[model samples]
Target chain A: MKRWLLALVLCLSPVFAQHPADSAFSHIYVSIEGGEQYPFGDLIDAVENSFYGGVGFRYAYLENIDGFILFDYSYFKPVPEGVKIYGAHQFSGKLGLDFKWKAIAPLAIGAGFVCDWVRGDYDEDKLDEISFSNDLGGTLTDNETEFGWFARLNLPLIRKETYKVGFNALWKELWTLPKRSETLSVGVYVERRIW
Target chain B: MKSFGKIVKSLVAFCSLASVGAFAAVDAEMEGMEVDQRDDGTFLVGSPTFFYDRILGAGGLHSESEMWSPEKLRQRMLLDRMSILPSWDVMEPSVWIKSGNELGDMIYRDFITAENRPTNRTPILEGGFRTPSFKGFWVTGRAFQDDHFTTSNFSYRKSFVDDEFAIFGENYPMFSTMYAGFGYSANSIDASFLAGEEYIWIFSESSRWIPIHYKPRLEARIDASNIEATVAYEDAEYQDKRKKEKGARKELNGSVYYRCGEACRRGMLQLSAGLAFRAVDDSGMVYTHLEEDRAFLPFVNLRFEPFNNLAMEAMFAVNERDWLVQDSLEFRPPVPRYTGVVVGVKNISGTRLNPLADGEEYFDGDTISLKADGQMNLVQGYTAFSDTMGNVGMGGRVSFWAEHGAETFDVDRYVEDDQMVYRHGDVERINSWIRGVTGELWISAWYREMFSFKALGGFERVDGNSSRFEVTPVEFFTSFTADWLLRKSFRISQSLRYRSDAQWNLRSVDPLVVKGDWYWDATFEQQFPAHGLYLTGTLLHIIGSETIETPNAAENRLRFICTVKKTF
Candidate 1:
C-alpha cells in the first residue's frame, strides 16, 4: 500500500506543477473549545464534557477564489471509575475553495473536501477472564482514512490591520472506502487571521 | 499439492470476481458520474451519509416494599420465594460511530453500565465494530468487560459480485443500478451471573431447588444483488440444557420499478416475495426453543400524488408458516408461523420536509403543518408449548394534527402473557393480549393565544378476554410555549400532565376471584428554546383500591427529580 501510494503521488505531482507561491497565503489560525451533552425526560440523566482543538490556514489562490486547509483533532478523556472507560479520537483535514461575493467586505462563500481518521476503544477485561470467546472478547482497534467534500461560508466580523474575526458555517461529507461509508458534518468555526 | 493448489486458486478467483461484480453494481448506480480524487486528494460523491451518536446517562434509585402478613399468605410455600428490588446509583454511557465510502461501511458501538448498591457493586462494558468489504466480504471484532470476565471476537466476510443495481432521484446523480456483497462476523460474550439470582431463589425456597439458564448465540447475514438471494444463520449453545441451537434461513427477493419511461410521470411501485425456514433441537445441546417451521412472505409498496403537496404511500405484506418438527419436551408440533400486514398514509401541504429540523420555532413549536399517519398490525399464533391452542389479534397506531400546533389519536394492541396466566384455563388454550389507545386535543389559543396552551387527554383499555376483564388508563396533559425568531432560540412556558391506570386481573391461584384497582402519575417540564437544553421533573402516586385484601398493593408516594441538559 505504501509503495502504491508513493507511485500514485509521484505520477500526480506533474499535474500540480503550477502550485501557487507561499506568499499568496493570507492567514493561518487555530482554536480550542469544550462542551457537554445531556438527555431529556424519563430517560437516564447524564452530562458529558468534551474538549477539542484545531488548526487551519487560508490562501488567496485567485482574486475571487481562496484556497484553504485545516486539521482538527478531538478526544474524550477517561472519567469516573467503576464505569467502563471508552474514548474516541478524530482527526480531520479539509481542503477548501472559497468564492468571494461582493455583498459585504471580506465575506466569501467556500466549499471543500475533507479527509479524516477515527479511532475508538472499549475495555473488555471482564469478558476475557470468563473465557467467553465465542463472539465477544478482544481489544478492538481500527484505523480508516475517509475522503469527502465540504462547503462553507466565511463572514469576517471584526476586520483589522493584523487581526480579523472569521466566522464560518461549514458542511462536510467524509467517505471511507470499501464499504463506501459517508458521514455528513455541519459545524461552525471562529478563527483569527494572522499572516 | 495439486488439490491444495486448486482450492487456493478457487478461493482467489471467487473473491476477485465477487469484488468486481459488487463494484460494477455500485458504479452502474452512479449513472455516468466518475468517482475522482480532488487535487487535495479527497473522495467526492456517492450516497447519503451517516454519522456518530454520543450518549450518556446517570440516575438514582429509590424503592420501598412492605412484607406481607402471615394471614394474607395464600399458600405456605409462598414464603419460599421473596422479592427484593435493587436500589442503587446507576450510570450508563454509550457511543456509536459509522463511516464509509463505496466499498462498505463500519459501525462501532459500546454500552457500559455501573451500579452502586449498598450490598454489591456491578459494572459491565461491551463494544464492537463491523465492516463489509467492497465485493461480498464482511469483518467484525468486539470486546466486553465486567467484574468476573472479559471476552472478544473477530470475523470476516466474502461476496459473489462486484456491485448491485440501484436507482436514485434526479436530485442526486446516479450511475449504475446493481450491487452485491458477502460478509461474516464473530462475537463472544463472557460474564458470570455470579451467585446472583440463583442464590436468592435457592435460599428463599424451603425445598431443594436449582436455577439454570444460558444464552450464547453466533449469528451471520449474507445477501446478493437485488435482494433476490440472501442467507442468515445463527448457532447458539446453552450450558444449562447441554444443547446447541442452530438455525439457517435464506430468501430470494426483488423489486421492479414502473413510471420510468416518461418525465411526465412520477411515483414508484415495488413488490417482493420470499421464503424462510428455522429449526431447533430438543436437547440442551443448542440454544434454541426447539421448534421448526417454514414460512413464505410477499409484500408491495406504492407511492403516488394526485396533486401538489398531496402525496400518498401504501404498503402491505403477508406471511404463512407451516410446522416442520414437533417438540419432544412439550409433546407438540411447532406452532404455525404467524401472519402480519401494515398499512400507512400521510397527508399534508408541507410533505417535503427534511428529517432534521432546519431551525427551531419557539411559540409555534417547530414547523407547523396538518397531517395524519397510521399503521395496523395483526398476528395469529400459539400461546405455549405442549398446547394446540392459539390466538389472533390486530393493533395499530394513528396520529392527526393541524398546522397551528394542534393534534390527536392513537391505538396499539400487542401480545402479552399476564392475561393468559391469570385466566387459568388451558394455560396453553388462553390467548394473551393488551390494547392501548391515546388521544390529544390542543387549545393553542387558550394561554396567551400567541402563547399556546394545549390540552391533551386520552383513554386506553386493555382486556384479557380469557380472564374476563379489562383495564382503562386516562390521562390529561397541557403545555404552554412561545418562540423567538425562526426557532433559533426560545423558552417553553411549561407543560403539566396527569395520568392514571385501572388494573383488573383474576387471581393466579384462583381464577374464580377477580381484583381491580387504579394508579396515577404526573409530569412537569421546562425547556430551553434552542432544542439544546431543558429541565424536567415528575410525580407519581396511587389513587384508590378495589379489594380490602389487596388494598392496592402499596402506599401512596411521590418522587422529585430535576435535570438540566446541553447539546453539541
Candidate 2:
C-alpha cells in the first residue's frame, strides 16, 4: 500500500512543480468523474449494478490533444444469486490518449489500456459447493489480477474559463478468471485547470 | 565452394575499403562546416551490416518450426544514390548471405499418419538491384538460392529467379501506373516417399487515379496472375509406377478506392471496394476424371471520421475459392508378358492368346477434394479525450467482428493388392459450416517522453457443425504492456498476456480443448543515434509454465535474443 501511494505521489508531483501555463508543451488539469457500471458475462450472475468514482491528472502537450493517467475504484454489493458472492471490490489504472474538439462546446474523446485487480468475498457454503482444483493443483481463489482495454467519449455540458462539467460513456472488457467480463458505464465529470 | 568463398571475401573487403574512404572524405568536408549544415554522405555509398541469432529452446511435440537453430553468420550490404549515370536518377543495390544449421525435423501429419524428416544445414544467398524513376520507369531484378542439407532420408533444394518493371505518371492530371513481373521457382525433394513439383508464375497490375474534390481522389486498379505447376510421383511397389500431373491456375482482380478529407489528420474518410475471380484446371493421368473449377469473390471497406475526436470503420467481404483436390493418387498395373505356353493353351481352349495385350486399368488410391465459401464483417469506433497541454491523452475503441464459412470435402479410399483394386463404393462427401463473433475493447495512455501503457481485452464465441455439439466453446484474451524511456538513448518495456481455455472440433473429429496459459516478456534497447546503431535484447516466456496444450503435447520453453543493427 505504501509503495502504491508513493508511486501515485511521484506521478502527480511533476504536474504541480512545473509551470504549465507559460510552457507550450504543458497544460495541467485535474478531474473527478462518477458513473454507474453494468456487469456482463460471467459477472452478471454474481454482481449487480455498481457506481464508481475516479480522479485523474491530465497534461495537454499538443494543440488539441492531451495524455492522461487515472485511477478508479468501484464497490459492488452482490445480489442474492447462485454462487453467493457477498461483495466485490475492483481497482484499476488507466493510461490513454484524449482528443479535444471545439464545436459549440468542447467534446473530448478518449481511449486507453486498463489494468484491473479484483477481489470478492464468498459464502463458505457456496465456496465449498463450487470450488474446483486448477491445473496447478490449487483451488480457485477469490482474488485475481486481470488486464483489459477500454474506450470512452465525453461531452462537456457547461464550460467556463477555468472549469467545466461533462458527461461521458465507457466500454471495457475484463478477461480473466477462466471467463470473460464486460462493463459499460455512463457518468458525469467536473474538470478544473490547475495551471 | 572455394570459388564462391573467394568471391564473397573479395566483395566484403572492397565494401569495407569503400566505406572507410567515404567516411574519411565526409569527415574532411565537414571540418569547416557548421554542425547543422553537415550531411553524412557516407550513407549514399553503402553500409555493411551483420547479424547473428541462436535459438535457446522450444516446446511442443509439433513445434518443429519453433525449434532452436544456430544462425552462424548473416551479412548484407545496402547501396543507394548511385546516380553517376546520365539517364538514371538513382540506383540501389543489395547483397545478402546467410548460413545456418537447422537441428529440427519437419513433421507432416494427416488424420491417419505422421512423418518426421530431419534437416541438418541450410544456406541461402541473394543479390538484387533496383533502379530509381527514369522517365517514370523503374526496374528491379533478383536471384536467390536456398539449399537445405538433410539426413539420408530426405533431400530438399530451392532456387528463385525474379524480375519486375514498372512505370508511373508523375505530373499528369490523373495518376497512372502499371507494372509487370515474372517469377520462376524450382524445388526438388527426395524423400522416402517420391514426389516432385515445379512452379512458374507471371503477374501484372495497372492503376489510374482521378482527383474529384480538393485532395479527394478516386483510384482504380486491375491485377491478373497466372500460375502453372507440374508434379511427378512414384509408388513404392515391386514395379514402381511413375505418375505425371499438370495444373494451371489463373486469377483476375479489380478494385476502386476513394479518399476524401485529410487522411493523416484527425478527421478523414476513405472507402474501397474490389472483386476477384479465379480458375484452376488440372489434367494428367493422376486426375484423369477431374474437371476444372472456378470462383468469384467481392469485398468492401470504409473508414469515416464524423467528428474530430471520433472515428468509425467497417469492412465486409465474401470470399470464395475453387474446389481443390488436396492430394489425389492413382494406380495402374503393368501389362503381362506373352509366353508360348499361353498360346498353346489358348489354341486348345479355342480362345485368343492375347493375355499380355490387355490394356492397363486405373484405380483410385486416395482422393480428397475441398471447396469453401466464407463471409466476414467487422465494425469499429474510437473516441479520445485530452487535457489542454496535450501531454496526457486517453482514448478507447469498441469493435465487433463476425464470420461465417462453409466447407465441403469429397474423400475416397482404395486397396492395393497384387494388382490395383479400386474401392468404388467407399466414397464420402462431408460438409461443415462455422460461425463466430468477436468483440474487443482497447484503452491506452501516454506520458510525455517518459512512459506509456496500453491494455486490450476481447472475447470470441465460435460455433461449427460437429457431432459433439453445435455450440463451440468461448475464449477470452487480455494483455498489457508498459514502456518506460529512462533516457533519450535507452528504453525498457514489459508485457503480460493471458488467454482463456478454448475448445474446437476438427474434421468431424471429437472436440479438443486447450487449457489457457499466461505469458510474460521483457525487452531492453539502446541506441547510438550519431552512428546509426541500435541494439536490443529480449527475453520471452519468462513467467509461463513449460507445458501447453497442442494437438500433441507441447512444452513451452524460455528463450532470449539479442540483435545489433547499424547504418553506415
What's each prediction's TM-score? Answer: 0.28, 0.34
lDDT of 1 by residue, B308-343 (tens): 433344433333321111011111223344422222
Model 1 gets an lDDT of: 0.27
Q: After superposition, how far is residue B324 of candidate 1 from its true place, in Å?
A: 18
Q: Mind giving the per-residue lDDT tens digits that candidate 1 earns over A95-150?
A: 55577877765778876545555554555554342232112111113343335456
Candidate 1 stretches with Cα past 4 Å from truth are A1-195, B1-230, B241-270, B285-438, B442-457, B461-499, B502-568
Q: Model 2's lDDT to the true fold? A: 0.34
* Candidate 2 interface CA RMSD, Å: 19.3
lDDT of 2 by residue, B415-442 (tens): 3333212232211122343334444554
Chain B fold agreement for model 1, TM-score? 0.31
Clashes of 1: 95
- Top DockQ prediction, candidate number: 1
Error of 1 at A118 (Å): 27
> Could you tell me which 10 consecutive residues in candidate 2 chain A have the lowest summed lDDT?
A132-141
DockQ of each two-chain model: 0.05, 0.01
Alpha-carbon runs more than 4 Å astray in model 2: A1-195, B1-271, B279-369, B372-443, B458-474, B491-493, B507-510, B536-568
